[model samples]
Target: MNTRSFSFRLLAWYTCLLTCIFVLLCALLYLDLSRFLEHNVEQSQVRRAHQITDTFLATIGKTGPSYVAGQAKALYEPEISDRFVRITQANGPIIYASGMPKDGSFDPAEVPAFPPVSSRESFHRVKLSNGKTLVIAALNYHGPGKTSYVVESGALLDPAELNHLVLQLLIGLPVAVVIITVGGYILVRRALTPVERITRAAEQITQHNLSERLPVSRTGDELERLSISLNRMIARLDDAFQNSKRFVADASHELRTPLTILRGELETLIENARLDPEVRERATSMFEETVRLTRIVEQLFTLSRLDAGEAQAEWSRFDLAGLAKTTAEQMSLLAEDKNITIACDAGQAVVVEGDAARLKQVVVNLLDNAIKYTQSGGAVQLHVRRANGHAILEVEDNGVGIPSEALPHVFERFYRVDQIRSGEFEGAGLGLSIAKSICSAHGAEIEATSVPRKGSCFRVTLPLSKN
Candidate 1:
């Protein structure tokens, strides 16, 4: 009962959700990538610092400021003030350092540890006990592992720069999000316009108005296919509804005649019970009427089971031609009494997988109808062949054919021809219908074609059995 259209809303929400997810993923990737680049740059800078230190240590060994400004330490400028570098020797005495290695008391304890403890890059920033941050890099040279020159460097990060980067991201994210939200909504709405039309069309269609169909652009896209499919469904619904209504009307009319006869016989017997013969005759007639009614009910139940997909076939591979020949042979007598000849043209062996017993019944029913309805001296031919992956079983009779308008209704249940209304020739009119149902259950199709006073042919096509 809740009939809200979900096309545009669902599309919009999906677009927004996808956009948000991608944006978050991009944001995380950007931050991680930036950190990775920065870490690699810091490592490279540290490696360079270590190389500078190693050069000095290789030239100068174990000496104090008394040997300051050694020839090997001349490349380092003292003007690079924020960093400290030095070459030391045995007993940890500074033999050379920055400041042209000028005489100065730059105490080792106050200057901080040379390559401030680090796991990678031989580099780190450390705060001295007196409150100054220094970045250091080192390499051991001209001595055992610990005895070496040390190089240190520093670059202070401004507090304002960090704040500015954060501000840029915060401001840009909202603007992008707002623009994407609006644009995505508009785009989704435009894309789903056809869907919205389908929804509205579906809403407007009721049982009485199933003739209404969804509008189709026929663009061959999924949405267009959806519209076409919906329209087809509506067309089928309208057709099925009409068939049901007609079936009900026809069924009621067919049943009423037998019931009317039964009632009339019963009413006559009660009114004239004193006439024993008449009463017995009336009772017998009523019994026959009841039997006919029972037959109709059983056929209806059988068709219902077939329609509901409850009929399972007991399948086996068998010769369709053999069955056709046998059925035609048996019907020869009935045809002969009307001066009608029965001939068969069965080929080598048309094999098909199906319910053999059920299929034989279909053949027998068709043959019986052909014989019963054919004029005297008319011929009934049974042909069985294999063609196009199907076992074609055909029954053609030169008899009183059905009208073209009535051909479509011949397979419908309880449809009897007006010309064959006599009790002897008249049947329950369920033979062809039951035959059709059986063939359908076995994955086959049966059709009948007829021309008035000319002839009729019923064809049953069954898939040929590979086995």
Candidate 2:
């Protein structure tokens, strides 16, 4: 705490700026007070000195030379104390002194030393023989021709008052500084509390606890928004971790089938005499499984590319309708084995920009999925058309369709609609996942519609080229 925090820095800057302003104000105040006090002393003392001279002139104006020093002293000394009073004839030598030095003498050589009087200013400094400084003032009682008395008088300020003023300034400034620093620090800390809380939350996060989320409060500030963002990132990471685990398990399990067949074929060949029909039959089954394994391996590679965003769709204007007709013709042979008919309801050639090979893959995967599940005499049909500024392709079948619960996950890598314990007869379950990825890369949307024991259909919509 003594070393200071972010809040303390903010407070220190704020207080420094305010303290400078306060010091400037205090300096101005002291200057104004000095001017005002000096003016009061000069004007009052000068007025009294002029009054004494005016009295002497008035007597000379009336009785003539009757007003003397003893009468003047009696008239003014009680009214004004310790004033250095002197009267000169305009610019001439000293004529009278009512409040001057005692022991009868007007010594011109022993004149008091003082700063020169500024007529423009009311106050001037004068030094007594004792070295005490007095702020003094002078005035001419009358104008030149009959000019009689130039009167002067002043008072010395007390040293104790000056000392008190200095002490108060020193003590007051430090107290003000402390108050400002403390109050400013408190306010800054309250304002930045949210930021500190966010820092603590980030520190607590670890790889083992990705499920943990940052705490968000009613303060819907920027820090709260940041917490929300962190929580979402953590959730996505958790999902990806789980997906990675499932991918490894499913890949290993799928490869076991082909590997088991190969091993069984080799075992038969090793344990029995060669050139036998039954042994040859086992070899043929193993060979088919090997071909299936190669296809699955290729699909896995495609999935890896799709996830990494390396599977780029080549944009080309082509006849989607013609492509559908050709793809249906190709899949018809596979359908024929199960007494299923493959038909194409090809609309007019709708030219679209998309990856030709990937779109062909989408059609082929749909056909494969449809024929694989369809019973004898069931039909698998391919439909291509243009609507809503898009080229829509659909594959529909009359077969044992997918359950609604499993349909959502059918496009996930290695996810099986019929779990492995039941439908090991079907190939690896990356077909629809490939179809989904291809559609995505082409900037198209794909969806599945299925009814349990009824039928399943997948539709893909691609944007039609405006040109």
Best by lDDT: 2
- Quality of model 2 by C-alpha lDDT: 0.73
What lDDT is reached at residue 351 by model 1? 86
lDDT of 2 by residue, 338-435 (tens): 89998899868888887788889889998998998888899888889999889989899988898888888989878887775337447788998888
Candidate 1 RMSD computed on C-alpha atoms after optimal superposition onto the true structure: 18.2
What is the TM-score of each predicted model, taking all chains together? Answer: 0.43, 0.46
Error of 1 at 17 (Å): 34
Error of 1 at 63 (Å): 98
Native-referenced Cα lDDT, model 1: 0.69
* Error of model 1, residue 421, in angstroms: 5.9
> How do the residues 1-467 of candidate 1 rate in per-residue lDDT, one tens digit apiece?
22255655665576678667867876786677656644654565566565654543344445433443454345555433333555454356566555421333233345544423333336555565545444445544435455544444433222344456567767876776777767776776788777788898899997646767778887889988888788888888888977875675467557767676776766666567576886677677776767667566656656655554544567678898998888888878878888999899996799888778778889988998889889887899998998888888899998888888888888877788774453557578888888988887888899998888889999999889987
Which candidate achieves the best TM-score against the true structure?
A: 2
Q: Where's the lowest-lDDT run of ten residues in candidate 2?
A: 101-110
Instruction: Tell me the lDDT of model 1 at 113.
Output: 43
